[model samples]
Target: MKMGWRELIRMKQRFTLMAIVTTLIVLLILMISGLADGLAYDNGAVVRNLPVEHVALSQDAEGQLTRSFLEQTDQPAGTEALGVQSMVLEKQNGTKDDVTVFASPVDTVYGPKELATLKPGQVLVDTQYAKQSGTAVGDTITDFRTKATFEIVGTVSDGRYSHAPVLWTTLETWKAWQDKMKTNYVSAFISQDPIKTDLATYTQQQIVEQVPGYAAEQNSFQMMRIALVLIGSLILTAFFYILTMQKMKQLGILKAIGIRTRTIGQGLVLQVFLLTTVSFAISLLLIWTIGQLLPGDLPFRFEWTTSFGYGGLIVLTAMLGGLIPLRALKKLEPADAMGGMTG
Candidate 1:
């Protein structure tokens, strides 16, 4: 609408190039952010859903639940061991299914359900698994460990962990199976200690940090996203700089004719803002679209907060990037106009 915007459109090729580059950079950042979100969900959502806020695993290892141990003597008075395991179950439908076996002393977690009669060979399976396996209550499932068979007593809703349907096993049954398997590991224990444990107790975030490659993988994504931000801003600055510098004569003429430096600065900044907005919009759309195309089990979780945060970062980077051009435009000399006029 103003002379500044009019001038920006005059260099169609340069403006188009800047917009295209920004679009690509923004798209890349959005995609990476989506993947990062997915990884975070995959890392700990189901475990995190368990009511307790802190976790206790073997001080000896991290990540693999099979490596943790909770001695009865060392169960940390107020702490609860959330015993979990992998077991193969044979359904009445005559299909073999792999399930994560969960054994807890009480239903303090997973929406809180206390089974009055938890004994050997009585178990529960998640609704998702039951749906997939087409099994109903009173259906007996054989445990591959010690070949200890279990009868499906109840259907826990939406209980899943590490891509497997969860099954409820009695703590006693779990102990017996652990003895049979020779692993004797009870995935991880939870503590409601206004206190710490004799073993290493990790806060929720600390536990997430221990997930294999989560930190490194996140760092890699962050670095790439940051670089994309910088590059987009730098490109905007360089293009505006070149255009403004080359048009020093024109600026001088406009200044001599009473044009304000502020007006010229607006032109450069608006151009940057316009291109950046378009790039960011394209990127946001691309991320959502691509995420939709991903398989359900691919572990991509695009929370609104994360998506909005990344988009805001992209916009801020684009805005900050134009500061250099603002300075360069501000310092322009009217004298350069005469030099151009003379040439």
Candidate 2:
């Protein structure tokens, strides 16, 4: 492997160019993949991570939270019905603060803040919002519509829905400000199993698919992923073919010397593996450096699984690229190298 690497480095100019090109492509796709994952998490993480068993959305709501309310049927049998509530919230000092308020039961999950630090005059906001808004532990924020002021209680680390910041307030708070009455648009409910013994259980994927924006948002990202994959295949194919053609004489010379095509093929595949390994390593480093330079809002985050997954893809792409040259090798007629200029 070390020898193979040295050979690649020996052809510095050509290998450098190819490596750089491939590295950039890999970096872009991987970063895009990360961003897509980030968006997905941003859209659903808080809700998904909650310690709830099931989510309840009105059958009439058509899976869209904004347009749907919770029907009585959607509510858990044991749970009591709470009137509608909404709040007008804006980020502190932000020209246009974007915060979401949910109508929740005053007792169950969305009830009053669990922390002693939080009081009735205020609500809990996701940590992201507090960081973005520069709001402190306690600050007075106006409910624009109600013309009332609400205090910011202790910060909560987990609170984001549909990729937007969220604020947790009582059902009555929503009603006092938003004028929502007997509305079922409670959107969805989270509960542990033994789920009222009446409601059916649906996986998160099933539930998310039912969400109005879920399919569209996910579809768009999938399309982007598909496009990048195709481009990767093309680039790899083109580069490897060109690299093989440039080394055609070398191949002929090796063939003439009793070097089996198998040996040459192995060498080429090895070369590609080495190239992709180095390129991907560099690309990962680049992404980390770039991430440090960007602001918090930039949507580019991924778990270790994502990087490992992309690395496998990079290797696969390189192998496919190297495979393209094999076809050209089979086409080589040993006689051509006898004494002729070839393109």
Candidate 3:
């Protein structure tokens, strides 16, 4: 460690540049990861909060909740039928915003949050919606489709769907807004017990993927993450390779003075490890600081577990980068290294 510190001190300018580059790459990766998770949560928090293990959709709907429709007669006994629709909520100021309306039996297992019996004409909205629209409990919001108005009775946390806030209402209220024929049908079935039926069943994860744009958005972010990892590794490897080459004559002099190749290799690995560790720490601090300054509405979610996991990967890649030069050093003769021939 002492030798590694000495070496870095001697080449402060070059190592500092490498550290800055590494810090930027790591920051980009962590920011991308947070955005990906935030988008996923924004799109699927409602489904993720469901108490059921699986949801049953109509076979002909092909796993799409919006297309699936189950009549009262088709619903299995004891299963909770849920109605979902994309609708607009008209603010008192005449502005409107899109929201996903969810109609479930009050006090049922499928309800995302625990609440008292919900009366007809009253609705519970996600906290995000309440804040965004500046609507409070006892306020009224108009439905753009049916021109029906609902009184906000309460607010629930983490209630979202398809990147929109969820509006929860009683099944009766949902029926009142729908045509008579469609009123009898529900979008899906939720149950804590295992369902035995001909309808297709999907786990929560599969249902999340069924949300519009969910799959595509996640795939793009994943590709970006993979590319960033490759770029960071390549950059670190090249930097270490060039640095090692420049110090070959110094290494040869040390070897002539009886320094073991193993000791020199260990020192190089230690240096890389220290640089990567410092860069990662700096990146993490920057991410946290920026996250604090971001607007509340911005979709950025940070998880310490993810940060630690990626930090470990960065360390591993940095060590691997040092190994490339270590391999060349092992094959070098003291005389050849002193001659400074580029290989």
Give the alpha-carbon lDDT of every model. 0.69, 0.66, 0.84
Instruction: State the displacement of the C-alpha of residue 19, model 2, in Å, after optimal TM-score superposition.
Output: 1.4
Residue pair clashes in candidate 3: none
Rank by TM-score, highest first. Answer: 3, 2, 1
Candidate 2 lDDT trough over 10 residues, lowest sum: 78-87
TM agreement with the true structure for every prediction: 0.74, 0.81, 0.90
Please identify model 2 stretches exceeding 4 Å from their true place: 1-6, 71-98, 103-121, 134-138, 145-149, 172-185, 194-201, 205-212, 340-343
- Judged by lDDT relative to the true structure, which candidate is superior, 2 or 3? 3
Clash count in backbone of candidate 3 = 0
Which of the predicted structures, 1 or 2, would earn the higher lDDT when compared with the native? Answer: 1
Top model by lDDT, which number?
3
* Candidate 2 residue-wise lDDT, 1-343, digit = tens: 4434666878889888888888988888778877777777777655565655455445554544454455545577644333322345644563455466654666654333443344455677777777777777677787665556677766676646666776766655554554423333355555554345333344555555654366688789878876876787688778878878877887788787787777777778888887788888888888777767877676667556777687777678768777878877877766575456455
Error of 3 at 267 (Å): 1.3
**Alpha-carbon runs more than 4 Å astray in model 3:** 9-14, 112-117, 180-183, 340-343
TM-score of 3: 0.90
